[model samples]
Target chain A: MSITAILINAFALVCLIYGFYRDRDKAVKSLKKAAKSLFGILPTILIIIIIIGLMLGFVPPAEISRFVGEQSGILGVLLVGAVGAVLHIPALIAFPLAASMLESGATVMAVAAFITTLTMIGIVTLPMEIKILGKKFALLRNGLSFIIAIIIAILIGVIL
Target chain B: MLLAGMFIVALILVSIYPDRRGAVFNTSMDYLTEMAFILPAVMVLMGLFSVYIPEETVVKHLGKASGSKGFFLAILFGTLPTGPLYVAFPMASTLIKKGARISNIVVFLSAWACIKIPQEMVELQFLGPEFMLARLSLTIIFVGLMGFVIEWMMKRTNGVIDG
Candidate 1:
């Protein structure tokens, strides 16, 4: 367990003690509600993440690197950003893939786009977010993320 | 198209016989464990917030036009935060449950996921100082802008969960 987990555990214990002493019924009910909400969604998120991982495993690095390496400037940045929007690889997975791509001569702009979108945008999570937060909010948030991700990439490209 | 069709069928099947299938059953268990561990803590945090962190503190730090300073602060706080996104989801849910404004939770989450400073430091070792700095600047700008947009949209819809 991480320090975070330990801290959370300690804090939870204190809360539990406080709640149990103060209002047992409310404490128990709140915990149950929290558990129910977490359980309800975890399965779907896990399945989706696993599916994404499997799909990512199939793509060839050379193809991705070549495209990113193209000297098409603004278009290349935009394309990379679009790709980032659609993909949701975690940072752990993305780093290694990016390292290899960099080794293979992909441009910094492309990798920046990928990393930004990989964290910021969520094309795969769109359906889930839409269901949870409603369509308009989810779309607006994601749409903005997509645009900002590109701008971020280009900014990184110029500054770095 | 084929994948989409298959996913739709799968969703239907899960909804109908959610527990009958082994994969779905196991998945549900994972979800249960995740929630069991996280939710209580989130509620306590909410309760703690009610007790501790002043509303003025949140408002002053998290306000829409707080600019880069607020954004940087948000990122620093966000980076130190550790929990599943679900933890934030529920806290945000419960904060809205307890009359916290939509903008607060929205900004909290946007910054929570985006500007994790510690995570960025680790990332910097690999991505380089220049890339890390640039990403940081951009994320702060983007999340700050997002907070304003979320607030505006909430007002327009008048359907924010907050009361």
Candidate 2:
């Protein structure tokens, strides 16, 4: 396992032990919740893995670069940002997909925009947000998030 | 439904384009392995947070916080690895009902959406510390600003916000 993997696992293990020491019932409850969620998200995980496979397999690096690479410019970054807002993938899975895109020739700006918007703005869940948080708040938050995502992406592009 | 469709599509495509099968399998395996290494641990952490840090606690704390303290509490509460942004909708709504500042609510929602602890760890693993840190720092700065901007807009257009 990589260092990240090891560290994460270690952290979880330590937390688990401490939780158990603090409260056996809650610790067990946490484990159950963990198992339930692991299974809950498993399907989405598999789907993302497959999509990544097909994406990297069929799409040429040149094609990816041509669309979202360094030369694709601002339009490409905006395009990805819009797509990110519309798509509802879990943010955890998005990182790997973003990494793959980065490896395949997508620019840092494009990937950053993709990640930012994908996580921050949720067009798919807009109605629920409106229902719960009020129309103005939801719309304003999502709309502003889209703009903020782009600005963050551009800054990341400039800085890194 | 999407999962099954994707699996069938992957099978068909791999069979038809036999030459690309190796690439597909290799890439998928690489991702699967990486996911396998971290996902369970991530889930465990999420579970613990969900159980230990109940929504009531969050509301109690954030509703009382104000000014810079509220912003700090909002971001801090938002970064906890609990659930998706949608799960936070009701909590934010409750905060608002409790008269939590609009800016703090916005900051809370944005932080919950993106700047999660587990989410950051995944980014660090896949994108490296440099990319992760740069994006993270920039996100914090911009998201903080966005809170104020959205709050200002909402205030100027008051009475438009339903419920």
Highest TM-score scorer: 2
**Candidate number of the best lDDT:** 2
Question: Candidate 1 lDDT, tens digit per residue, B1-163?
Answer: 4446545655666567655445544544543353344434554544443333344454444444345564455554455454333334544454454555555555566665555533453344446667778788777777777767776886787666432
For model 1, state the Cα shift of residue B70 in Å.
Answer: 7.1
Q: List candidate 1 segments past 4 Å from native.
A: A1-65, B1-73, B83-87, B159-163
DockQ of 1: 0.15
Native-referenced Cα lDDT, model 1: 0.57
C-alpha RMSD values across all candidates: 10.8, 1.4
Candidate 1 structure quality by residue, lDDT tens digits, A15-118: 66786787677666656654664455444445543333222333344565557775566777778778777876544335434544564567787888777677
Which residue pairs clash in candidate 1?
Answer: A39-B31, B79-B116
Q: Which stretches of model 2 miss by more than 4 angstroms?
A: none
Worst 10 residues of 2 chain B by lDDT: B154-163
* lDDT comparing candidate 2 with the true structure: 0.90
